[model samples]
Target: MSQDRDAGARLGDSSLLRKLNLAAALGAFLKAPSLTLRELRAVIGVSRPTAEDLLAELLTEGRVEETTPPRQPSSGRGAGRPARYFRFRAESGYVSGLDIGAHKTLAVVTDLRGNTLATSRRELDPELDAAGRLSAAVETARACWVEAQLAPSDITGVACGVTGTLRAAEGVHDVGHGPVGSGLAPYSLPGFTEVDVPGALSEGLGRPVAVANDVKLAALAEHWKGAAQNHRDIVYMFAGHRAGAGVLIDGQVHQGRHGAAGEIGALPMLGWEAAVERLHARGAELARSAGTAAGREGEMVITSAARQDPESLAVLIEFAEVLARGAAVLALAVDPEMVVLGGGMSRGGPILAEPFRRELAKFTLVPLEVVTSTMGADSVALGAARLALDTVFAELLAVPGS
Candidate 1:
């Protein structure tokens, strides 16, 4: 027994055991309608006492529900007694998510199962500084919470999806059209750069908060409940005023070394100035094709030319081909199961999907499945909500049960 204890200690600490037990219990509960103590112990490979202790905590927390014992077979000879079972409650609480984009900010409130209860959206100008943008975003978030009629206390967390680089170590950078602190004047989020956007909003709303890049958030949302649900390795691109992508490995979002794995727009084209000019020239050409003459769309505009006018369809076709080049580069490196199209212009539906597929086929080592995001404008916000729920309720799912 002493040797066994020592070996167990060496193999895994109490904390590691608890996490493993939690994962086992949660997996069992999710896979089946109900589970028994004996079955949970067998699955977790933990001692009976440890399993019982974990289950007790879960039951006390109302995350799992106990049920009557199963019926035993008639005992003409000798029949074993039935065992009590447990399963997830699923309706315990909710989380909130928001996606703040260049043109629009959206919010969604969802249950633990990722079901949306209410949603709201507000238009925005990319020219607004980080502080100004946050103010508008925060207002939209508050309205969504109010419309849902949920108390601030009931919210476990709020997850936000913002465009630009998010350095967990250095914080979010390049939030709007200008410098982090200077550009946000109109909406008035003082010290936007210094404060953690998630933490600040969480404090204001009295809940925990999580944040991720907008494109990554959209990828996660689609990974969890949209077009990429069937795939483990995937790439999601949100092409607009700025183009970005989110890479997934085994269903997990990859942030890369700098938390900027998908900054596809920065890839060099003809070289620095020329490449920048080419990107803008496309935008200008799009505007002219749309009959705007001077060829200017709103601030940070990319789709205004592609989606709003038929004359610009040729330009969009070329743009889509360029997008395919980016996708091919990503695929050659990552080799994802599918590539999902998202963002405001993806609303173009199959028009964008087919062209992208054609362009992608021209290059790349492996054939790729390209599809449109099923979640639409709500993808990023919903993904944020999913991230929050995973953070909070995921713990409850671990408790073992009778």
Candidate 2:
């Protein structure tokens, strides 16, 4: 009996090692466009036979495919026959990302490597009930999948980003009582905090869903493919009709204990609410004078400022000063290397960047570079897709029964 138990232990150890080798080979393939047997063995530090075995298994599973290397010109020196190479099958599956905000819901479909394949957007009434909003988000996701010509089974993972703090309990995300003192309540969907966001999205979309704060996802988007990609520690400020922030430390989002790591705008003393209201009031006045709809008043104000409107520029400068105060608080605490300004206000471009940088410099102990988001309104949804891709890779690389 003791001998049998020892043999079982040996089998378990061998299985674990095999799993590790397989994961390493797969990671190498994902990073490089293609790899030969010798190249893969060198990368994973495995024997030639072991690397070949792993590639065979991956090929059988349809996760990898062989391809001929590019032809080389004949020279006096023999470079040897071009070695056959293998590449990861990034088209093996797909994932979906959804951004459900107060005013709009967006869905994006992506391949394994986070390349956008299809996208759909839907406008939502801020007064819509929680159920109505959830239904709209689901519809948008389905529309995106249809546009991509993919079936539900083709989706390997899904993630959703929403406004407000998310509290997870038994896989259900309870969006907490919404943000405070950010002047977004008037524009937020009613009763959004009282629903299970992940559960609703998962059921409606016919798949499991991961949920996160929209601002946090925006920060992740910046880290993944935006201005902060090269920086590890960052402060991502979402300056829209409402104000919020997201923090990244050591290249990972710092969500605090309850996933509220960057709710500094919630503090009434920060004056975030007052500043937003001031912008809104001025925008409304500008819109009325121009005989245009006030739907995008804040943007109008920024546009006017861009055109050298003195009054608009002054309001923008004051808004920047107020924003700098809250940003300084975050910068002082985290000492981030960079701060990325995103959302609608960022579209003001240099007209906004100059004043914001000038004001932020007044409070920070050390100088920090501030850049605008290039992802624009799609940042949250793109971040959601990234999260979904992560889930797919985790599952793909997971070792069974270990």
Q: What is the C-alpha lDDT of each candidate?
A: 0.71, 0.84
> Over the stretch 202-284, how does candidate 2's per-residue lDDT look in tens digits?
88988999988888899999999898999999999888877788999999889888776888876667778788888989999
What overall lDDT, based on C-alpha atoms, would model 1 receive against the true structure? 0.71
Q: Pick the candidate with the highest TM-score.
A: 2
* Regions of model 1 farther than 4 Å from truth: 1-33, 46-53, 67-84, 175-196, 270-310, 393-402
TM-score of each: 0.75, 0.90
Model 2: residues >4 Å from true position, as ranges? 1-12, 68-80, 170-188
Clashing residue pairs, candidate 2?
none
Clashes per candidate, residues 3 or more apart or on different chains: 4, 0
